[model samples]
Target chain A: MFDNPERTNLEQLGEFGLIDHITKAVELKEPSTVKGIGDDAAVLDFSGKKMLVSTDLLLEGIHFDLRYVPLKHLGYKAVQVNLSDIYAMNGIASQITFSIGLSSKFPLEAVEEIYAGALLACQKYGVDLVGGDTSASVQGLVISVTSIGHADGEAVVYRSGAQVGDLICVSGDLGGAYVGLQLLEREKRIFLENPNIQPDLEGKDYIVERQLKPEARKDVVELLARLGIKPTAMIDISDGLASEILHICRASGKGCKLYEDKIPIDPMTYETAREFGIDPTVCALNGGEDYELLFTIRQADYEQVKGQPDISVIGHVTDADGGYELISKSGNVHPITAQGWNAFTSR
Target chain B: MFDNPERTNLEQLGEFGLIDHITKAVELKEPSTVKGIGDDAAVLDFSGKKMLVSTDLLLEGIHFDLRYVPLKHLGYKAVQVNLSDIYAMNGIASQITFSIGLSSKFPLEAVEEIYAGALLACQKYGVDLVGGDTSASVQGLVISVTSIGHADGEAVVYRSGAQVGDLICVSGDLGGAYVGLQLLEREKRIFLENPNIQPDLEGKDYIVERQLKPEARKDVVELLARLGIKPTAMIDISDGLASEILHICRASGKGCKLYEDKIPIDPMTYETAREFGIDPTVCALNGGEDYELLFTIRQADYEQVKGQPDISVIGHVTDADGGYELISKSGNVHPITAQGWNAFTSR
Candidate 1:
């Protein structure tokens, strides 16, 4: 996607020089930030709050395909994925360390494009770009991000906190990102077969954007706090709704009953799944990378979030012997299974 | 190097199962770690202390050659390199996130070997293995580590605090790791040339250990704190002594006069460099990956460190106009340059 003719060779600027060029404009905005960018390590002082940290590594072929993914969007998505982990804990992300391994094929402008996307995400999330390491890769690009966040000790949520009778809720719609991926992959194959024909993604803006630049649910955390409602358990939906719900069930030693009709699926996503010969319910259950918040709250707090516009109450926690099940719209119950993305398998 | 006859395929156990298998034995030793593995994010409470964070990415074939390097050693070195950055800031590393991307060729036992070494390092350094991401790579191994550390606000040091006439000092010996790398490369070539012949690496224990498993100088930070002596400026020597000194000079806006005779070099390193037909002083100057702490202390406080065993007084700082210079043992002055590892360049 990088067709800039005036590309500068990366070798012209050494590693230290490249770091200086990219981070020269960094301005730390957090009062807790004591040092950033130019130091051996970023320094921060968060006295009363508990610290939260999460890291993710994205490989070129396994985690992403550059043939259809833009470098800038890849950078933005990488940061969002890590920040999603922090937000899942009901914490406020404050800083991130972004490290990348680039092959010789990448030019200085390509790296700049990626950094611009990363910086843009940081700006939107109010996170400071702290410290990172840059190195050369043998073949393809590798992106690693570590997000640091903080929350009051009492406010932090864990996956093992869910209790029986809690209401299961999710923010925003699901299956959109998976449908977007299918469209992009189909377009990529067509373009490779015939370079002259343009991709037919004319009216698929919402799904495509959902796949390319999905946003973390930082606003959901803020909204819940504003409503004086705290989730008993929470997790970000990166590995499908089924997998995340199972994570909570396994951790909390409880079972769940999910209502299929209550699962929110965007119209575009449903239509696209039909076109791809896939079930919309299956897509919503197993499609990953939605970046939405899946959580549970006490039954007493149901009135606080009952009519929220973006929040959907999909199910409720049950006793361990009830087992994990999905009650279909037609009144049939099916056992829930986690068939989320398993990178080790070639499926 | 993994030649087990009955190797277990990684696909047999999915990503979550693999993570559980590898980290099941991890015991949290730090009181600050409120939560560790098996969570969306690790939680820590470093109350009343300034937090330091750093990250590093290491790729196969680019950062290391698996043909000569052991997987366990690679894992150990990756964690050590990141911890070195924390110690450079005069902090105590307490927690780390270790993420890796493995290809299909690697068996489950191979990954366990790497984690074993990583756990060993964590046990030795009193750092907790908190959380990480594991995925599959298309080709080679990819390792990324993020180290979290803490120090009292008053005890933290920075690279930009050096003053004119400050004494430049470095801990431990230099050039050993570089020479050790040379020895390993020579043996690899010899083995490649003759399949049936055994390569030789006799009586090179110290230098080889330095290269294969370099330790972070956490002890130096503790020693300085115990002596009630804080460095005016400090940095870890990862990109060679010359590069690190220049970093201090550039950040502090000062010049330095490094004495070639005062640069500490192990006797085995000196002999090995001569045997390889290389200049010992040049190796000491530009050879990287030593993992030693280089710092500057005020002249008035020099008395505290003058009689220390492993520390050496290499030079003194000067006004910016004096420029960075190295006075050779033969009385000739030469400008210092950073010929450190530039990943983009083949050299």
Candidate 2:
């Protein structure tokens, strides 16, 4: 009964097009709303502190594979994924609402166990379980989480503040989650082919845990405040370091140089990559879902957090004319590509 | 690699158990958060105003049937449901975040059409479109919308605020959406058996629209403000009138009385119910997807809003001992039972 040409094929305009088109019509008239749409979380004024709101949805067979994934980790990961957005803005998550599409095959207790894991994460993260809806689904389960956080208005960070010569830092390790997925898929196929056989899962604990229960770098956000250091720009590393670097570069109108050797890859991840016959550096650069924090800090403020063992200065913001490049240990420089997690490829 | 207690039948807990179990381990320590999980929305202090965060998820084949429903109304209804929860709190909706999961079957055109409907609702409701995430799905479309609204600390209404002898008022007519659903289902069966048959939806325009494009009651909220009246208790009728009445009564620890003849049903809805051989009154009380506001006001303020055509004073809230009952035109008292919508019944 309704057909409007003004709004057409989303693919024709692409995902970014869909977002840009929808956002153009929005009018953020509220005086308290400092920022909307562009940041990791929508910023809201709440007395002395600011409120940050962010939402995300994960679907079965698309965002996850049930064959190699447990429901508990899925639930925990859903909350963490949403929380990462709030932390990206230097905000502390305070409340979360989880909306789930429940398939009929899932019984009451099974679903509760999933929520048990989610509520556990809420407790760990110090966010309240607010409000959500549970509806029947025809296929696998779908979970959507919205997290709201609080921050000092002046402390809120955006993705467009990287200046030339600023240092790019990443928290903890990278490429472990992607490598972990490969290991799980490999074992899953072997087990599926012969039900009687017990597959081996040794020496790959770190990578597997990274895939299963990856914690968003909330600690880094707190540590930054503790050390009295501020990031000029910040974004989480979910869509691989390569894509995230491009997001910062494009948004900041600056180029970047990532030192290959400086990228932190755990020993388990490197060893696992060798076993799988894949390059660890490429896996870290292109494989996604690390949940690490990729941010930029002023050169002068770097000294405050430089001694921290967990955070690593992997690269530096360069002039736009410099172009995005990665320098390897052997001194070869290659252009960094924005090949991250592509949901459309599976379809 | 994933297998456990979910293989067989497991249904020990009911809906209440599910909710309690889901919320068991959550902790809310934020000072700005006034209420969480137990109420309709997460209440927070937005400076002097009380802010609310509520979320809802709508799935294909469960909440809607894609066979007959258009993508535009589906998108519009998704946003409206979340806005309804905000309106339930007696607050002005400020912003919304939309998360969607689409299957490969849908071309990009369909996704854009859905957003067009979402953007249209945002424009009509004066709410800002903030942030959301989208992913791929294997089967059907799933949409989750989170809405944030704010009201003065003193003016925010909750379900527990109702008192004895208060007047129960409903904004706009009911039962049309329910009757419209029946018509759509009946036509879908016929169309499924033979695609050549056309849906006879010409004469049932109002009922069809009611089912297809339900609007949130921001107007009633505005009118109440203009008339200098605050509702003692409020809820949105997304799960039929009888179910909502039971909720209000349960929360307020009181009972209510309704005049059967006074219940508002559009003429077209009545005709459709008659055509479908269903009780029109029962449909008015139990039909859902109306997205109308249900509130109770003090008896003295009845004159304040009685002149408005859209605002219907259905009945009065009675004492705790009164029990929930309906007084028919024949002077017979009948106990009202809650027959809320349950999506568990697949057919």
Candidate 3:
């Protein structure tokens, strides 16, 4: 699958040689990282701060199609997915350990490209690339990332901390990533049918980038801190807005009222959903992988976040007895249910 | 392949259901665990101490074969392997994040058995299962474990700290895991040839368990601490003696003399290797996955650890120009070379 001009076989360098070649350029940027890469275990000091740990596993075929997903983008997204979890907890990620398993079909250059992308993300996020494991897989590529971060214990946001009357807010836009995936998948089928036809992905850059290069909402977290507002409950939108909102309500032992008209959707995403004969509202509610922040803020703090262009107030928290409900633009009220994709059955 | 009387398909529980079912029984025993599971990230308190992090990825066909490996043992061994890296650094592991991707072929009971084994290891090691990710793979099972630990700055060890006059010591015995694997492969071959034949594995419990359920050298680390001995350099013997010692030598810019006769091999391992027409010394030198500690201490501190039965002083460090050499039983000296299994090329 790799189309690189220089194709060095994996066996020629061996596992240790490949690790050295890939990580030789890695410079530890975090002061917390006492040791990185060379040792059996990386050493870090997060004294006086509570540490946050999260991991994500991405499998080829199940998570992404190699035909459309570039190796560099796959590696970058894998790290981003894990980092989003740390941000969701209002923590700043300081270090990450990336592990990968791939078959011999991957050449040395392909592996290098993946690490280059991972290192780029680490550099941009100001996190050190710590220790990791690399091995040969029997089939496709598998990536697992563990992100370590720290925050003051009192400042950490949790899904179970929402209170009644808290305003539900979301950052940036939603449904763009899911729309982007649909566009990519459609183009893949066309290319497979006729290799001569190039992918017609022009002018869809915003949505396509959403699918290929989603970034964690680090800026949103910083903005909230600058505004001196702490979210009562928070989660990253990975398994769609409906699923994530349900998680918050379940954990907090409360319910929420979501307004369909208030859900943020970019113009490009809305038009693309209509082109695919799908409801844009449905896409925003159930389409996942946006990496946007969904959180609850006390009513008194609404004035500070409402003035921010990127933050959209969508709903409000309610008592558990009220049940989760959605208010449509036409004033139709319906129970909000989770239609999140179950990886086990969806594949 | 599963012969269990009750089989619950993974799809029946879905991703969230499966995670809840598996982790409902997990009890957070560590005081450092501020929050375990059920959140965007696991919160931990490692105040005033340096945190040690390590990760390991295991693939089914490449790292193991289900035809011979039981699910519970596989789960147990995966955790042990990662924890061994922490012990190699003279750190006490306090938490682990386990991520698994398996195909639908596995039943819920099988997954439960695997988690049971992992939890059992956590209980025994005084570590907490803090966070993890679960997803469906397209093929066989995949597990990635990240272990986090802590140790005092002075007590922590690294492979690059060895000096010229330091003595080399190894805990427990070597080569039993490899010899046991050979026996298991033989039994499988015999069973494949005759479907009705019951293979003989009686009187081979020690070697067989070594292959299936190898334990990390936590006790050895404890013993050294109690005896007021700290190794200048330390590493876990996961990649055989020659390869690990070479790592120390290369990292420390030093060399070593290893005596073949001093290499400790269990009688069961030696007998089994002889039965297979393989040299026991060669097995001890190159057989991976022993999960024992190989370390170097100052020569002046030799009297304290010399009487310890489990610790074997096999050799001493030398200058970089001296090169790595092994002294044979007949007094012939030869350069020590690494024959550790290269996962990429070996298959």
lDDT of 2 by residue, B1-347 (tens): 01333322112332223334434433444344443443112324466565677788888878888888888788888888888888887888877777677765565557666777887787788876665666667868888899888777677787878899899999999999999999999999999999999988888889999999989999988989999999998989987899888788888999999998988889988888998899898898888889899999999998888888998887888887999999987989999987776665454
TM-score of every candidate: 0.99, 0.87, 0.99
lDDT of 3 at B116: 85
Per residue, candidate 1 scores C-alpha lDDT tens digits across B52-167 of 99999999988888887888898899899999999999999999999999987899989998898888889999999999999999968999999999999988899999999999
Q: Which ranges in model 1 have alpha carbons more than 4 Å from their true place?
A: A1-5, B1-3
RMSD of each candidate relative to the true structure: 1.0, 12.7, 1.0
Residue B260 of model 2: what lDDT? Answer: 88
Worst 10 residues of 3 chain B by lDDT: B1-10
For candidate 3, what is the DockQ-based docking class?
high
Candidate 3 local lDDT, A1-347, one digit each (tens): 46666788898889988899988978998989999999899999987799999999999989988899888988889889899999999999999999999888899988987888898889999989998999999878999999999999899999999999999999999999999999999999999999999999999999999999999999999999999999999999998999999999999999999999999999999999999999988988999999999999999998899789999999999999999999999999989999998988954
Number of the top candidate by DockQ?
Answer: 1
Candidate 2 wrongly placed segments (more than 4 Å):
A1-45, B1-47
Per-residue CA lDDT of model 2 for A264-324, tens digit only, reads 9999999889988999998889988999989999999878868999999999999999999
lDDT (C-alpha) at residue A261 in model 3: 94
